[model samples]
Target chain A: MANVLIYANQQGGNLSSNAREALAFGSSLARSANGETAAVLIGPGAGTAAKEAIAFGAEKAYTIDSPLLAQYQVELYLDAISEAFEKSQSTILVLPFDRKGKDLIGRLATRSSASALTEVIDFKVEEGTVHYVRPIYGDKAYGEYTINRKKAVIGIRPKSHEPASRDENRTGDIIPLKIDLSEEVIVSTLAEKIESALSGVRLEDARIIVSGGRGLGGPEGFDELEALANVLGGAVGASRAACDAGWVPTSFQVGQTGAVVAPDLYIAVGISGASQHLSGITNAKTVVAINHDSEAPIFKRANLGVVADYMSVIPALTKALKKRMGVNTG
Target chain B: MHIVVCLKQVLDPELPPRYFKIDPETNRPDDGVADMVMDSYAENALETAIQLRDKIGGATVTALCLGDEDSEDVLRRALSFTADRAVRVWEDEWENLDGQAVGHILARTIQSFGGADLVLTGYQASDIEEGLVGPVLAEELGIPCVTLASELAVEGSILKATCEAENGYQVIDVPSPAVFTIVSSEKNVPRLPKVKDIRLSRSKPIEELEADDLEIDAERCQPAVALRKVYVPDREVACEFLVGEDGPELASGLAGKLMELKVL
Candidate 1:
C-alpha cells in the first residue's frame, strides 16, 4: 500500500486554503491506493493545522512547530519538509503547487532521489501504480505519464481538486517532529518581504472575474472595469498587455506566465484574446467578451460577445447590473 | 566571474489554433507543423546574465541547451545577446527525458567546465512548465538554489535575488556557486539583437556532446517520461452575439442576457 505524505502549508497558527485543498486531495489518493495519508505542518500553528488535517482526511499528522517557520524560507522549509518526508517513510509526497512549492519540488525530489511531476491535474490507479495527467504546451495540450521510479513527488496545481470536507469528530494521531532551525542552516536567507498594493479577492478563488486589456487606453480603463466587477461581485483581472503597460499589477495578470485561474464567469473587456491569455482561462466556465472589434479572437471562445468600446460599455453594463442585482448606488 | 545560462527551444506558444495538430501515433505535437523558437523565459534568463555580466566587470556568460540540432538556434540567439560561449548536449534517440535525466546531464556538463559562480535558468519551460531542472541541477551539484526570481543583485562577493511570493515578494541572499531560476518581466525585457552581434554569434563555435559521454547508464538514459497519451483539450464554447445599435445598447443587451441566464 502506498503511504502518501503531504507538506502542509501553514503560517503563525493559520493553515492556508492551499493546505486544506491538498489534505483533501492527498487523503482521497491514499484511500484509493489502499494506503494511509499523513501531513507535515511546519510553523507555530503546526498543532492546530495537524488537527485540521485529521478533520480534513489525513490519518496522522507530523508537526515541526518552530517560530522560524512563521515565514517561508526556502532552505529552512526544505530541510523541515525533507526531515518530515524521511520520518513518514512514504513512497509518495504531495504539496500545493504555489509560490514556495515551485522552489521546493525539484530540491526535495533530488535530495530524496525521487522523480517529480509538477502541476498535476489528475491521477489514476491501475494495478497499484499511479498514472498522472498534467497540462503542457501552455495548456494547449495535456500529458499523461506513468512514473518509472519507486518514489514520486507530485505538485498539485491550485484549484485542480476540491477541498476536503471537514469531520472534526474523526479521530487521528498528532506526532511532533524535531528539527534544528539555527543560524548556520541559512544557506538561503529570506532577507525581507515587500507587500504588494493589491487589495481584493484573490483572482484564483473568485467566482467571477472582470478583466481589462490594452484596448482600454490607459490606467483609466481599469477604473472602469473595477466598477463592473464591483457591481457583479467579482475580482478584477488583466491581460499581459495591460500588465506590461503598467496599467495594473503583475498579480492581476491572467495569462500563461501569470496566474492561471478557473473562475466560473470570466468577462473580457477591451481584450483581443492572445493564445497565452486564453490558456490561463481555459477552465473558466462562462466567458463574456466586450470589445470594439467584432473580429477579436476572444469572440471564438466566449460564451457571449458584444461589439462596443469599453469606455462607453462598462458604465452602462455596471449601471444595468447594479439595477438588476439591487446593489447599493450612491 | 563565470555565469552559466540555460536555454530551451520549444514549439511556438503563440501558434494559431489551425496549426496546432497532434500526431496520432506518438500523441505529440505534429512535427514541422509549427515553427520553433527559443523559449521566451530563457531569453529573460540570458538577458539577466548579460546585464549582470555588464554590471560586474571581467565576467563571462555561457549559454547551455539540451535538445536536438534545432536547439542550436537558441544557443546562437543567446550568443546574439552577448553570451561568451555555448554548449549543446544531446544524443540520438534521446527524446522525452524526465526532468531528473536532464538534470543529471546538465550537472555533469557544468562540472566538466569547472562549474560557475552563478547558474541561471528560466523559471520554467513554457511547454512543460514543471521548472524542475534548475533545483535538481543545483542539488546534483550540492549548491543552493532560488526560483521564481525577478531580479538579481551582486554585492561584494554576495548575490541577492527578489522573488515573488503570495501576497508579496521576498528578497533572498546567498553565496556564489548558486542556482537561480529567473522569471520574465516587461521592465527587464530581452533587448533586440544588433546586426553586428548576429555576425559575431555566427562566428562563435558551439561545444556539442552526446548523452552517453555523461556516463549515465543506458537504462537511466532512456526517455524520461513514459507518456500514456498527449492530446489537445477542446475548450471552445458557442458564442451568442449581442447585437445593438450603439455601445450603450450593446452593453445593456449583454447585461440583460447575463441577468436572464443568472450569470451576474
Candidate 2:
C-alpha cells in the first residue's frame, strides 16, 4: 500500500493550522491509494500535536521530540523528519507550502531520491496515480503535474483545501522516535528575532486587511489604515510601491513578489491595482478598492470600486464601521 | 571568498493579466511579452552577493544560470550590475528537466567550480514558483541553507542572515560554505546598470557549460514531474462600482454593502 505521510508542522509547541489542511489532504490521498495516513510532528510537545493529528483523520502519528529541534533550524529538522519519514516508509509525503515547508520538501526529496511538486493547490488520484495542480506564471495560468518517481513529495498551499473537521473521539497510535542531534552540524544559529510592529493577527490569518499604496502620500498614511484595521479587527498591508518608497517595511508589502494573502475582506486604499499586486489577493473573498483615479486597473478586479481620495475616505469608513459594529470611537 | 548567485530569467511578472495567454497544444504560456527580465528575487540574491563583496574586500561574485541561449542576456546584465564572472549551463535536452534535475545540475556545476564559500538563490522563481533549487543544491553539496534571507553579511568565515519568520524577522548566523535564498527587500533593491557599464558588459565573456561537459547522466536528468495541462482560471467576481457622489456617502455605501454580504 502507498502510505501517505503528512508533516504536521508545529510552532511554539502548538500545531499549526496548515498542518490540519495537509493532514486532511493526506487522508483523502491515502484513502484513494488504499493505504494509511500518518503524521510526523517534529518539535517540542510533539505528543500533544500527534493527538491533534489523529483528530484530523490521521491513522498514525510519529513524534520526534528533541530540544535541538525546538527552533526551525533546517539541518536539525530535516534530519529528524527524514528519520520519521523512513520509519513510516510512506511513498507520498505531504507538506505545507509555507516558508519552512518550501525549504524542507525539496531537500527531503533530493535526499530520498524522490520526485517533488511544490505549491500544489489541488490534487486528484486516478487509477492510483496522483496529479498535483499548481499555479504558474505568477498565477496567470494553472498547471497539473504527475510525478513519475516511486516516491513523491508535495507541498500544499494554505487554504487551498478545506480542513477536515476534528473528531475528539478518534483514536490513533503515537509513535515516539529518538534522535541524536549533534551540535557540530548546527552551523546556523538563531541570533535574534525582531517582532513585526503590528502583532495580533498575521496578514495571512487576518479575515480583513486594510492595504495602502503610494497614493497614501507617505508613511503617515498607514496610521489611518492601522486605525481602520484595528476597528475591523484585522491587519494592515502595503503595496510594493509603498514599501519600495520607504513608507513601510518590506514585510508588509502584499504582491506577487511579496506576501501572498487571501483574506475574507481586502480594502485597497489609494492603490492602482497592478496585475502583480492583484495576483496576491485574487484568492481574497471580497476586494474593495478606494482610489482617486476612476480608471485605475485595480477596479476591474475589485468587488467594490470606490473612486475617491483615501485620506478623506479611510477615516470616514473607519468611523462608519465603528458605528455599525457598535465599537466606541473614543 | 568566492560567492556564487544562481539566477533565472523569467517573463516580466508585472505584465497585465489581460495580456497573458496560454497555448493549449503546448500547455505553455505564449512568448508574446517582448520583455524578458531577470527574476525579481534572483536580482535580490545578486544584489545581496554584490553587497557582501563590497563589504568584505577581495570577495569574488560569480553568477550562474541554467537556461536557453536567451538566458545569456540576464548573465550579461548581472555582469553590468557588478558580478565578476558569469556561467551559463544549457543544453537542448534541459528544456524538459524538472526542478529536481535542475538542482542536481546546479550542485554539480558548483562542484566543478572547485568550491564556493557561499551560494545564493532567489526564494522562488516567478515562472514555475518551484523554489526547490537552493535547499536541494545545499543538500547535494552537504551544506546548511537559510531561506528567505532579507539581509546578509559576511565576517571572516561566519555569515549572518536575517530572514522573515512567522512572527517577525529572525537573525541567524551560519558558517561559511552555505547557501541562502534571498527575498526582495529595500536594502537589496538591485542597482540599475549604468550606460557605460552596459556597453562594457558585451565584452565580458560568459563561460558556457554543456550538460555533457558536466558529465550528467541523460537518464537521471529526465524530468521527475510531467506537465499534464495548463489553462487560465475564469474570473469569479464582477466588480461593482459604488454609486456615491462624496466620501461619506461612499463610506456609508461600502459599510452597507459589507453588512449585506454578512461580513460586518
Candidate 3:
C-alpha cells in the first residue's frame, strides 16, 4: 500500500487553511489508493493542527515540536521533514503550492531522488502511477504529467479541492518525531510587520472581484472602485498599469505574471483589458467591463460592457448594489 | 559571491497553438521554435542577483541553461544581461530528463564550477512548472533553499528573505551557499541590453556540458515522471455577442441587454 505524507506546519498555535486543504486532499488520495495517510507538523502547539488533520481523515499524525521552529528556517524544517519521509516510507508526498509548500517540494524531491509535479489541480491513479494535471505557461494551458517512479511528490494548488467537513468520530494515529537544531544556522528573519487588513477575504478566495485599470487616471479614482467592491462584498483588484503606477499594492495586480483569479463575478472599472491582464481573470464566470473606451480590448472578453465613465457608473452601481443586497458598504 | 542563474527557452504561450504540438509520448512540445530567451521568473532572479552583486561589489553572475544545441541563443541573452559567463548543457535528448534529473545534473555542474556562494532560479518553469530543479539541486548539494522569494539579501552565509506565503508573507532565514527560486516581479526587472553589451555577449564563453558527462545514477537519468497528454481546455467563455452602438446610445440600452443575458 502507498504511504502518503503531508508536510504541515503551525506557528503561534495556528495552522493555515491551506494545510487543512492539503490534509483533506492527501487523505482522499490515500483512501482511494488503499494506503495510510501521515501528517508531519512542525512547531509549538502544532499538536492542535495534527489533531485537526486526524479529525479530517489522517491515518496518523507526526509531530515535531520545537521552539526553534516557532519561526520558519529552511534547514531545520527540511532536515526534520526529510527524516519523517524516510521513516514513514512515504511513496507519495503531498504538500501545498504556497511559499513553504514550494520550498519543501524542492528539497524533498532532491533528498528523495524522486520526481515532482507542482501546481496540480487534480490527480488520478492509473495502475501504479499517479497522473496529475496542472497549468503551465502561466495558466494559459494545462499539462498532464505522470510519475513513473515509486516515490513521487506533488504540490496541490490552493482551493483546487473542496475541504472535508469535520468528523468528530474520525480518529487516527499520532506519532512524535525528533527535531535537530544543530543543522540550523541563523541567516535572517523577516521583520514582523503589523497586518493592515485581517477581516476581508483574500483576493484568491473572494467570490467577486472589482478591479480598476489605467483609465482610472490617478490613485484617487480607486476610491470609487473600492466603494463598489465593498458594496458587492468583493475584494479590490488592479491591472498591471494601476499597480505599476502605485495605485495599489503589487499583490492586487491581476495578469499573466500576477495573481490568477477565477472569481464568480469580475467587474472591471475604467480598465481597458490588455491581453496580459485578461490572462489572469479570464476564468471568471461572468465578466463586466465598464470603460469609456468603446473599443477597449476588455470589451471583447467582457460578457457585458458599459460605455460610461467610472465617476458616474461606479457610485450609482454601488448604491444600487447596497440597496438590493443589504450589504455593508461602509 | 558568484551566482549562477539557470534559464530555459520555451515556446511563447501567446503564440497560437497551431504553431506548437505537445508530443503525446513525451508530454513536451516537438515544434521547431527555439528562439532562446530566459524564463520570466528566472530573468527576475537574475536581476535580483545582479542588484546584489552591484551592492556587494565582488560577485560574478553566470548564466547556465540546458536545452537543445540551439539553447546557446538563450545563453547569449542571459550573457547580455551582464553575466560574466554562459554555459549551455548540451544533450541530443535533453527533453527526456524530468525536473529532478535536471536538478541532479545541475548539482554536478555546480560542483564543477567551484560551488557558488548563492544560486538563483525561476520559481517555476513556464513549460513544465515543475519547479524542482532549484530546490533539488540545493538538496543534492546539502544546502538550504527558499522558493517564491520576492525580496532577498545575502550577507556572508546568511540569506534573509521575504517570500510569498499563502495567507500573507513569510520571512525566512536560511544559510547560504543557498538556492532560491524567485517569484515573478517587475520590481527588479531585467534591463534591455545596450548595443555594445549585445555585441560583447556574442563573444562571451559558452561552455557545453553533456548530461552523459555528469556522473549520476543511471536511474535518475530516466524520468521518474511521464506526461500522459496535453489537450486544449474547454473554452469557458461564449463567443456570442450583442450588436451595439457607442456611449450614451448603448448606455441607455445596456441594463436591459444585461438583464436579457441575465448578467445584471
DockQ of 1: 0.69
- Backbone clash total, candidate 2: 0
CAPRI quality level assigned to candidate 3 from its DockQ score: acceptable
Candidate 3 runs further than 4 Å off: A9-15, A178-188, A191-201, A213-221, A239-247, A254-262, A268-286, A289-316, A319-330, B16-26, B30-36, B154-159, B166-175, B212-214, B239-264
TM-score of 1: 0.94
Encode model 1's per-residue lDDT on A156-208: one tens digit a residue: 88767777788989878999987877756778887888887766787887888
Q: Estimate the overall C-alpha local distance difference test score of candidate 2.
A: 0.86
Error of 2 at B16 (Å): 1.1
CAPRI rating of model 2 = medium
Q: Pick by TM-score: which candidate is best?
A: 2
For candidate 2, lDDT tens digit of each residue in B207-230?
A: 999876786756558888999889
| lDDT over C-alpha atoms for residue B244 of model 3 | 43
Task: Report lDDT per candidate.
Answer: 0.84, 0.86, 0.73
- Cα miss at B248, model 3 (Å)? 7.4
Clashes in predicted model 1: 2
Candidate maximizing DockQ = 2
